[model samples]
Target: MTSPHDDPPRRPPVISSPRRAAVSAAAVTAVLVLACAALASAGGPADRRDPTADPAPEAVATSAPLDVAADRLTDQTGLAVTIDALSPAALEPGNRLRLSGQVTNVGRGSWRDAQVYLDIAYDPVTTKGALDDANSSDEPFGTRIVEFGLFDRIGAVPPGTTTSYRLDVPYAELPLSGAAGVHRVGVTVLVTNRDGERVEAARADTVMPLVAASDPTPPPAEVVIVVPVTAPIARHQSGNFLDERIAGAISAGGRLRNLVDLIEAVPPDTLEIVVDPALLDAVQDMSDGYAVTTRQEEADQGSGRNGTGQVEAEEWLADFQTVTARQNLLLMAWGSPDASALASQRMPGVVAAAVRASDEFAVDSGLITPTVSWQKNGASTRRGLVVSRIAGAVIQFVAADNLVNLRAQGESAYLPSLVTVPTEEGELTGVVTARELAGQRLTMSTSVLDFRQNLMAEATIRSLEAASAPSPMVVALPFGWNPGDAAEVDVATAFDLATVEPVDLKAVTQSTPAAYPGPIRLTPAQSPLSDELTDAIVRLRTNGNTFTSLLTDNADAAAFDRRLAVSATSLWLGQPQERLALIRMESRAAAEQLRKVTVTGPTFVALSSRSGRFPLTITNGLQESVTLRVDVRAQNPALRIDPIAELVLEPGQSRDIEVTTRSDSSGLTPVRVRLSTVDGKVFGAPWEFDVRATQIGVAIWVVMGAGSVILVGTVAFRLVRRIRTEGLHPREEPNP
Candidate 1:
């Protein structure tokens, strides 16, 4: 057991490095992608960026028709038209829109002759809801912005090949004259020779800025950057990773590197890191000069002999340890517990597990896991749950305000920053994880792009409103972000323009609370798979005591945790059915391990003498020792058996226990012997046996003799009385 007063962090023992296996190509690619993302996330000189390198415009906000395939048309030879990206999504009035994209001939045959045309159109609708209708409508809007004859030229696009084209149109060349709200940019690909052109092969439209009648909208004043530092690791309830996949992937180059880069890039003072200790804990588990394999067959063999696999761990812990030195919070991430689900179901061990994980990681690392720092996903859980006494103090980060009254329900009043409410479990801290529009893929090619852009621009604009404005606007980076798709430089550019600075989430949440008497508004939580997780956790209760006992041992505890890691919310987010199957499997495994503590003694006890002792044997099949007592139950009082002495069995060991029984009178009695912890929790199943008692004790004989003498004396006295009085009456009756 780790001492609470152990202030200094302990370094795991060192082991020799193992043989270097061949790094797979997939592993290499994963590394490169993470590296590129990291470099891009960190800001560089303006000249360093290539305008044409990743020219895809930030996402556009418009819904597409249900049948997106309708956007493309092909003749005998199939051809496809698409806009890979558009730059400068937000543009000033009269700016020349330089749109570039590609046209592909997807048919088996090549196109000897082809022509491309540029079409520009405008839509009056600007709001996302209205745009969605327009985007999804089968009928196109009649408004035409431009029909240009400038860039229509001959081209030969081969089958399985693409033709790239650029259209540079000045604002004066518009057919719309002076109308503007939002413009639709699209490309029309033509298949024809010099003879003529009529058939259009592909037509794809993307939204872009075309504010002709108005001035350009400036970028936001304050842009908050939230980044997630997380990883995918399946766990064993035994406190271990299902395998070495995490270590192997990370040790080489995997998405995890991007997280390391994110931590490194976050500005120190205001760095808000959401750390799920499950990942860290796995690293810790593997670093013990040992680790389990991800392969089912390998793990089936159980963990290796103590000195095995010592070379496999990544030592990623050192980097994480350094990063955690900055301000951060535990994101209820111990095992990525389904907070909303667990809280709703009122599961006993979930809260306890979270608290235990927090204490283990936080206290040992000298880091903070404030009750207020939990990033619950939705608004449904307005109040705290009444969990068992594990979370000494739990703090929540309500999405809307810095400090909620924790008791009020009126309209909320936003304060300067940080609302920390002290509570029994910890602090009910209120800080928002980034809202949808504020923290997500900055350049996703989807309908929500415009809304996201607006939020980005607004934040930047707000910050520039005043020098002392809420400069460090806080935002939590979305979890499960695809590192390969992140537009780090673009986001950084937006932040730089808005004078936005990276601030640690902890510093923001740790700030002094303002007096906001109003109610705190929170985002509604949407846990579609909550029920499944709740069900899984409920089943885990049956295995709790056994699991707890395992936790008390060194090896068993490690094994248990490795299996439990799979429950981490991030890892199971989109895979509820799979998670359910996993939980069931884990529960079954736990039950199986616990059932190994069985009794191996004789099934029957024959007693010739009234008083005697019987020896019973118990076998422990687990890798951990157990301190337990033998409980004896019998049906007959004649079979008196004392509770056997407490026995402690080492892993995979057995012991014999002797119990004494005394009987005054007995024939056959059913008896049961069961094992329990010293505190009286039944283990496995009880052993039922029959006890046969033959001869009585000497005391029984003595008592019987005394009774016989007393009976004789009473009879003699009665007879005398009868003869003298009553007896004489019987003789007279006879004579009459």
Candidate 2:
């Protein structure tokens, strides 16, 4: 939340444009005429000037140089002044405007009476460019404009002390052009001596549009307001929540709180609130103190640094649940990831995991909404919006929130007023915060001014409707990376003119012919996942192969994979570099944890006998015990191993098991085996061992002797009888 007061008084352009130059030249001529008249008047700012050249009365009385009496008069005269805040976001024509600021006397050199006054002048909005551009200039378009003192109070100040003052001036009294567009106003403090000369001290400028007087009966407006409830893409590092931005948002006076206040001000169905599932997961993790990623350079940072920056959740979840239940909730994909940013290879696994996260959240919160449309940075605008693969699938992902933060996306330059985006799904309405007001830090005056502008937009809508043309105004609340408590009241007042509930996006797309009219399309940059992360995700899926219907039975493995998918969420689209690095770190951690259930046994075993059994070890590194089996296969035909049945390994415990094997030939044989789930799929890495069969077994020798004797007897019997000749004739080919 940035306050407009925080911005220093903007300096006017050194070189005026051609138009301004002409206006300035004319202003010069006008000022000369006005000064001549004022001088002749009985009383004015320069009334009854002392003509004496010695110790000029105006300059000497203020104890400052004569040259600075007009432009910026610094407080070499021992007083410092500042504007703290201004009030009433409902600033309309014929209203009172409050300006709050401070004045301090530092040099204490003055012994007589001292007074503080305010100079406020209006400047009109020149352009629509957001911050960083030369869109705005402080030059007064109307040189006929004059700086007037507002609620100037005469007083005295002690040396080395500060005093606060609030100036309430009637809006109609100010020199206003009264046009409907954006206008800039500047305010500064000055200290005047008894000699009638005033010296400038502190200054600030407020840029906002003034609202025209409201019509007696404004036509009804069809509005849909969508508020973004998002946090930075985050992954729990070492079982701890690390994204501090999320923590701050849910804290008091944070983004979440500000948003909640705005939503609560509206009716339950007034606005649809969209939520990011990844945020919910992290907030839940924060219920207890959790560690976050600190230093990448630290070899084993492990997400915890002795409670250095750990944010244990206090009342965030409680507050969230209470506020969200008050309005409609939409489920954003896990991590609020961008569909376009998904890696081509990880899409299937990633979508499945994201869906699961949403389903699980629904189970926890007892709330769910269809994800018909989503907000993508740089894609969500008044004209062009980003869409993905098939529009139908996207219509299914996020469908549902309340505090409208006036922060803009990607760049701070977008129209802050409500805009209606026509889609095949229907009219998708949202606010593209004005470039000048996007992520604004507003106090009182600017808040009212900004609100009045929004309210004034209703007049524009009404005029079009009166012309027999109806167009709904969809508004989006401004968003900020970090919005402080600057424009706290304006957000709630955004709906003051007439309270109209915004239509739900899901219903709009379903009912309206407004399909996703993607006049423009954008594909995300190719996403990258390190080999280690890929391997870990593969293993996570592979590990579940040992279980039937892994989704229902393998809770632990499923949970771990869910975390990986959330970490890989497209929410990091705005932060590509950071996303890649975090994926690598989380995937590496997953691999380490998956390495727990390992196979341990001898690499070589000698077998002198025909049949023998050898023992092996299966160590469980996980916290929970597992029931599994060993899969064995002999690489050499000379050796055979019996099938293994299901077995169990205790947590942090080792189990020794034996396998039966037999060899008939005298040779060396290689055998391989791996841990397998009950469903019979390999688990950890495979283990192999060599078996040396030194001799032929007695069982083979006995079978060979019997076979030889039987063959010899058969030959003798054939020779004994001619009848045996039939048997020999049988060897001949039969008649066709």
Candidate 3:
């Protein structure tokens, strides 16, 4: 979290139109007038002239000239400053002097009014001779100084306006008696703005030609200058674009009822979220460390370093955007920003976006916010104007997370691996061939044995070339290629390729809406029944959630999605038995048999089983004659259930059904299998299953045998002892 103190004072983006520019210019003019008025009344920083104490004052000869007019003053800001203008000056050996100038605003906004200070220095002629393009100017000798400031108010003057100020220094204040062999004199100004932004401006004069006396009192050559960077004041009226957009949202419908409600209420918008650099840095420091892509390695690969730089940039930007968007929704949901600020109204939107972005971006590559800082380099009125641009933005994409990472990984080596595949004779052509052999047989696989093993005995065998041979066909093998191996020839199919095209570098579009991570089926307006169901959808969206979490212990997730289909099952459903929720869920279900789905990850679906039994409970509540028919379907072809058929039950009849499932060779994981119902809701009991090996009656048998052997052995032993020793067990022997 960024502290209020950490915020970089910001100037809103330049929304300069002809009219606006004129308005801004007029505003600047007004600011200058105000600055002059403030200066006259304030007496220019009382702190600079604390007369009464400090050891005492020294008297000097009237013949001596004053070295400087003003001594010390301070202004802080971030804008970079250059000398724009200066006042004329004359200097005599022992005379005092004054200097004045203006600092212009160069950054985005105005700095709240602040004072500017001067640094006076003296350098010997020899020292000046040593100065070069790279060297800093040195202080000259015998300079007296005083301090003064202008434009000290709550806000900065608008950019393009010049705020002028002056300072007076008397020569007697100088420590030097007057060493003179022609020393160079220089003055530099430092201004600090309200936001702690700093700007440095300087001017030097090395042409002061003077001759020193044989008995000379040497001047002090050291000068110290400290500039403060102040934060810029944030200013706005109620009619900004942001205000209008938010107002529109409020007019449509104030606060969103929930996450789904919010989505339904608004279309997607391009958002830029700004975060405190300091807070972000702290978060990054505490976060799980990022993957490091070395500079040397990237260079070797002919690519940019910081493999996740762009990824992190995008994610941080996106998360910020999402959070802000939710904030807007909260404002709408609660009817006003003030209302949304209340915990009750804020929580739902905050939590929802957190949960959504967290779950969505978890598996994402380089999804982290990084810290940044701003340097004040220019001036706005007396304030420092500072700004930095976002690194850059990628074209908006539906699967942006995946698409971005993939792009970063470089063009898919697997792309060319698709389309035309080399075969024994030639290449397989067209989508028909591609689809037929999609997962049927590895088109790139050269191993005849494995190919024949998985294929049906009567399966069609089409060689790349026409063949008249009886059993097998042969052709020239490409040199340097392994003869019989299934290689991933192409990762993309023609259908997949059709979805994307190359984008020009300079032509990249901004804010292209990315399909909000599987928005087609699991939309913002919809919610899953179970946390498990939610996990399943998230897994579908991000490929991050585990399938194990989605399944009912021993059952398949797809099977659960099917058998457990009802209003009570969706995670989005309100508290169990909520009247409004129940009705809404039922209506949604009735409107759609199976939601349309388009998966963008791996195309195959698969399933696995552990051990647990889902207790199935059938309750017959209605008094009228009724019948129920349940049909199950798995989304993935590889998923299957035993006895895949309709389950029928007559009125007043109830039965428990245990359906088992496993994945076939296709490896297509079942996202969900739907169980259609004809009448009455099916309430599924929690499934349970023994995970270890099934023992059956073995434990009972083992115990019974052990008991019988112990009894028989004890009796026999007692009888033998009784027989051996006449004193024993006539009872025991007789019983035996």
Candidate 4:
């Protein structure tokens, strides 16, 4: 008898007859086989086995089936995994996919016996819609690669603690085959939950694009990448910077600086940069010496601090000029105005003026001629198209969603990137930006490898849709896009793919336009400039014209046009307060400049006689010499005044002019004086005064003359009498 916890004793084997002996031997052999199987399944002698090495295939086959709920396999878990890097960005033959990142336990419970495995979907995403779904899907689908010891075994992760993980698996070992397009790849963590079951706890998914060497290279697709180099509106109407933010933007690590760096990194002709000439002009001023206002009111008051980026501005400008010298430069309107907004407001003159300023800047800066026009957000209306055409734009870049009757054959089919739009002026070649790609806003959060893979996937799918036929595509980078230090390489690598053929904007314009199913349809402007802002811009333009008319040189007026355009930039679309403030500032500056050249004189002038001369002073407070015409008028018809045909005054010079006046009657007469341009356009406000002429009448002069003659005759008669009567007075003369 044995106790409940005690082990029972075993009897010794005994052989009886020949048949009994055979049966006993069979039982013994069976027992020996069972013991051997148990040891092998347990990975016999753990000290003799390599923990890091993969176990025999038989070991995995003998293990219990993975017990996990299919619905809960991708459920959120305690661990949060983030992939910091992916080696060999694109999938290539004979290369291994290496991923390194951090795993943090964010839940209240700890994760024990944690393991990170590579998960991949073997099937390639062949359509744009499917690719979009994969990129955006929260519960992405993938099968874990649990063979060949390809996962990292991170022991345990306590609550609110993080641990690093690295997984390297050969490409051939990956569970993908058959297709060479974009495939879904991800990392999943298998941890022992509190229930003591090994299950997927957390996962992160990304794209992996593969371009095999053996695949036949089709006609390369024409790709036009339009990159916008712009900054916020920071310039005042007086050619001074309103703030110093622009200086930082063009510095070493600034947004504008990164743009220049990206341009320099890529092939010179690969990218078409839409540059705001106003930005360049502002930078040029900053390089020479600039004033930054502490307040908006100070901009016109000429009370501001000097900028501190003269050196940086000079270096940046020099580098920009050098880098852009060989690149394709598409000049934006002088201030990068909102063309669609201006068009919607029916202010075509402002748009035309902006375009003219851009053209002039292109010529003056020695940059390439601008043939293509791009509106903010790639949105435009029918009127905008016509206005752009009239403003010398042969081609216009528009958002794909803004056009109708432009659908593709299927979800996987390539959308036409070029079309022809009819306008009043002529036909415009419309370059449609790929809506899918542009929607994926590139930012610091997106890894370089991920972005490159996404781009490659798009290119591959589009090429496949067209049966490898040459397809023209255009991708417009978002305005003010800042590819951080990590993403700079991605931007350059995206275009370096073998399937991508970089082409100039001219090339895209020359390509055949895709046929639409019916008449082309254009959407209305999404968000245009408000009526108040547009009206303000109109007033600014009018005032600016008047102010510039005072300049002796017509060329000087170009600066004002550029400044007015700056007030209507797309940067002000959502900034109503700032836009209004800027417009007011510009208007005030213009008014102040116009007031500089004025006429001044005493409020009252007295003329003692007819044809008397009075003095009036004219002052030129402008920095440059001016040629002005002075016109004088008297309110009373009895008074007459002469006009000064033309007068030249040096800068900051004031001189008094003599006015000849004649009065038919003597009384107080109101007089007005004004300054005008040589072309007879009124320059500034009129100066008014009163002239009191005390002139002597003609009758009085005649009476006085007659009296004087009579008196003289009488005197002569008296003198003769005296001479006869006082003949003896001669002796008195001798005494005198």
Best by lDDT: 4
Instruction: Identify the candidate with maximal TM-score.
Output: 4
What range of 10 consecutive residues in model 4 has the weakest lDDT sum? 15-24
Q: Higher TM-score: candidate 2 or 3?
A: 2
Worst 10 residues of 3 by lDDT: 378-387
Tens digits of lDDT, candidate 4, 200-268: 776665676666642775445567777788877666655667666788778766778766777777766
Superpose all Cα atoms of candidate 4 onto the true structure and report the RMSD in Å to 1 decimal: 16.9
Q: Which ranking of candidates, highest TM-score first?
A: 4, 1, 2, 3
Clashes of each: 62, 46, 95, 0
Superposed by TM-score, candidate 4 places the C-alpha of residue 276 at a distance from the truth, in angstroms, of 1.9
TM-score, candidate number 1: 0.59
Runs off by more than 4 Å, candidate 3: 1-616, 619-736
TM, every model: 0.59, 0.57, 0.18, 0.71
Task: Provide the lDDT at 15 for model 4.
Answer: 14
lDDT tens per residue, model 2, 406-455: 32223322222333346554555432222122223222112323333333
Candidate 4 — which pairs collide?
none
**lDDT computed for candidate 1:** 0.49
**Candidate with more favorable, higher lDDT: 1 or 2:** 1
Q: What are the Cα lDDT values of the candidates?
A: 0.49, 0.47, 0.25, 0.67
